[model samples]
Each structure stands twice: as structure tokens, then as C-alpha cells.
Target chain A: MDNKVHLITEQDIHAYIDGELSGERKAAVEVFLAERDLPLERAARYLRNNFDLKAVRDEVYRDEKLKSEIDRLLARRKPRRHLIGASA
Target chain B: MTNQANTISTEDLNACLPALYRFAYTLTRNDDRASDLVQDCVERCLRKQHLFDGQNLRSWMFTVCRRVFLNQIRRDKVRGVAVDMEDAPQSKLSISAFQEEKMHYQDVVESFRELPHNDKVVLSLVAIEGLKYEEAAELLEVPVGTVRSRLSRARSRLRDLLENSGEEGTVVAASV
Candidate 1:
């Protein structure tokens, strides 16, 4: 994150998005990013991808219809090889 | 049955269902296909229960899911499934009014499916699935550095993809 002397590298961007950068270093990265538009958007989106994906996944899991469908499939699918638990 | 429980029961399989389906979805990028792949993987696990080392059921299930996906891909190729455009998504995704966030979820996940298989695997495991770098590396049988590097590259590539597709998305927010 020490971009004070050198240009912002991909490593700094990674740390910033992961929230590993802090204090002055974090601010410096922000300063470098604020001057640009696309890079900032990309960085923000990258950070949010983690959050967005988790939110979407939670939404999927919370869907009662999908859950019921999967449950029905499980109940209906005959265990042609249902020997594991029985043998054990 | 010790803590490892060499025999994987229906209860164990049930507990692992969500995680397995999630992993399968990351690979197949289709709901029904992912579900079918999970079922196939479950069958393989049950049939090969003696092969289960009895440690980390989720991890083992993930491995099985990935193998099943590969096998399906091979089968599809042999069966002459429709060839997909290298960079073209299977469906047109656009941003519509009042559902920006919902559309965005499809946008992101759809773009994710377009990424190289390795990138999708690494990013899903670490970012979406919440595996540590070492754990992902071990699961993937790659070095920790490789995982970190692939994750970085994957993050950038995913961003690029979303950016590329977002431009095509219809901006219908003004009416709202």
C-alpha cells in the first residue's frame, strides 16, 4: 500500500479491495484512484463482487420454492446405490 | 463411527447439499444442471464411501462435484452439444427498471460464467465460498502463491467482463 514513491501496483489494489490497507496507505490509494473514473469503478465493483455474490447466494437459498423443489427431488430420487449407511 | 465417520450417511449428505450445490453451480452455471450434477456427485460419493477418508466432507464433496462436472463436459462434447461463442454469454442480460440490484446479480454471475474455468474455480472458492488461501490451494492442489495470483487475476478479469457487458445493458432507470 506504500504508493507514496512508486505508482499504484495491482498488489495495492488487491489489498485495498480486500480491506487490508489502512490509514495513510489506504488514503493514498484512494487519492490515486479518485483521479481516475474507470479504475475506481472497477475497484469498487471488485470489492462489492464478494458482497454481491454472497447476497445473491443467500437470496437463492432463502427461496422457499427452490428449497421445496430440491427437497422433492431428493425424496423422489431412488438411491440405486444406497449401500453406504446400510453397510456401515 | 469415530469423529471421521468413514461411512457417510444420508444425514451427512444432507448437511453437505447446499455447499455441494453451490460449488456445482459455480462450475456448471445452470440451476438444473448444477442440481443434476450434485445428485450425480452424491451418488458417486455413496457408491465410493469406502474411499472417503472421513475427514472434511464438504471438501471431499467439492472434489467429487468438480470431477462430475468435468465428466459431464466430456460427455457433452461427445454428444455434440451446441457450441457456445467463446466470449458470448448464453443469454442476453440487461438492466431493467426497479430491479437494478436483482439485474446486477444476474449480470455479475453471468459474467462470472464467462471467465476461464480456472479463474471461476479460484474466485468462487475464495471469494464466494469463503475458503482460505491455503485451503483453496490444497483443494486445487496448487501452491498458496498460485491461489493468490490466480485470485488477483480472476478479480481483474471478472471486473473487465462485467464492465464489458454493462455497457450493453439497457439503462432504464430514468423512468423510475
Candidate 2:
């Protein structure tokens, strides 16, 4: 095992968690994180927080009222096939 | 009829409605405005159907939605309509009993609302919508690096807000 301590910056940690780092740099981040407890915990918490926020935001898309309203609007438009058939 | 050849099918348009509405809601943060934006986008798509390729319909719709939102922002700026708390619609998520996770989620949503519009847009596209960095960059008309940087800043700010808010213990009582 190499005795040298790898310095992991906050951005490096964020990128590492985000899966943006690659190859040797990624390997280095993994090694560094394995040796540290606090940073690893912090990265895990950040990821969890991101997932939680995403989950909450996803609720907006499930609004049945909005979906029905949009459906009503689209239903009003004449379908292209119908128009083509009409013209024929 | 002139644009009939390139028109999106009603089924296809309906399939993407939820995603389109979600993106609009994130950007506008107002239910009424988001509904209007989606309606306007669907109308424009029908009128300019000749411009749309059959594939990539989702991305095309997202690009159009973003453009419409930006244009509206520009118009609002010109008209000096400052978007403030008073302009914000009612809270869509009702906070019930003070469960820990619910409180945390509520704090997250409140902090998310406080982010700058650009930050919110970037974060929503990449994080909430699960768009790739390159895709978000393309939609936002910025380089990939800019998206990364913006996401980084947004995440950091959100973390700060969450931490500080937790310390402040500003959790409101459940409406029920």
C-alpha cells in the first residue's frame, strides 16, 4: 500500500459522488475516501439529500388535474390523420 | 394543413405531458403559469409541426419550453414585474405532522424555492429531470462545463441552506 496521503478537495468529492471523475483520478478518490470517515459520510449525506429533493420534485408531475387539463387542450386540436382524411 | 406532415401524434404528445408539465412547473414555480406554458408550447408545436422531427420529440419539446420560459422572463423584466413571495402560488405540498423526514423534505423544498431562477433551472433539468449534463447544456444553450459549474454551485448552496435552516428550527406547525 502506498503510504502517501491523497488530498481530496470538496469539488473532487462532489465530482466523485456525481460520477464525473474517471480512470486514475477516480481510483485515487476512492482510495482517499476509503481512508476518511467524515468526508465519506458527508458525501453520502449529500447524495441522500439530492435523492430526497428529486423525489419530492417528482410529485409535481403526478398531478392528475394538470394531466386532465392538458389532455383536454390537446383533444381540441384536430388530428393530422383526420385532417388528411378530410382533405382526401 | 401545411404543417401536417411533421406533426406529433396526439398519443405521442400526451405521453410526454407529465414530463413537460414537470419541467414547466420547476421553471415557473407557479401552477397557473406552468399550465399556461405547457398549453402554449403544445399550441406552438401543432402550428410549427413541420419543424419537429419524429424522433427526439422530448428534447425538442424541452428546448421549446425553455425558450418560451426565457422569453417570458425577458418580457417580465422589460415590464418590471418582480417575482416575489406574494407572486408565489400556494404551497403545493402540505406539511402535516412533524415527522423528521417530512420536515427535512419540506426544508429542502423551501431552500430549493429560494435558489436563483437560473440555478433552479439547471438543478431541475439535471437533477430532478435526470437529464445528462450534455443534454442539459444543450437545452440551456451553455457549454457542458458551465452546466457542471452551475450544478456544483447550486448543490453547495442548497447544502448550506439545509444546514442553516436545520439549526434555525424554523419548522412550521402542521396545517392539520
lDDT (C-alpha, whole model) for all candidates:
0.60, 0.61
Model 1 misplacement above 4 A: A1-6, A58-88, B1-96, B131-144, B164-169, B172-176
lDDT of 2 by residue, B43-134 (tens): 88878878875545665676577567657666654543332333322322222322333556677777777776667666666566555565
Interface DockQ of candidate 1? 0.07
Candidate DockQ values, in order, are 0.07, 0.08
Q: Candidate 2, DockQ to 2 decimals?
A: 0.08
Candidate 1: tens digits of C-alpha lDDT, residues B46-123? 898878766556656655665676576566545433223331233221222223435566787677767776786676
Note the B-chain TM-score for every model: 0.53, 0.52
Every model: Cα RMSD to truth: 19.8, 19.6
Q: What is the C-alpha lDDT profile of model 1 across A1-88, one tens digit per residue?
A: 2325637776676666554566666656665654444565455456557755554554443545544543443344333354334321
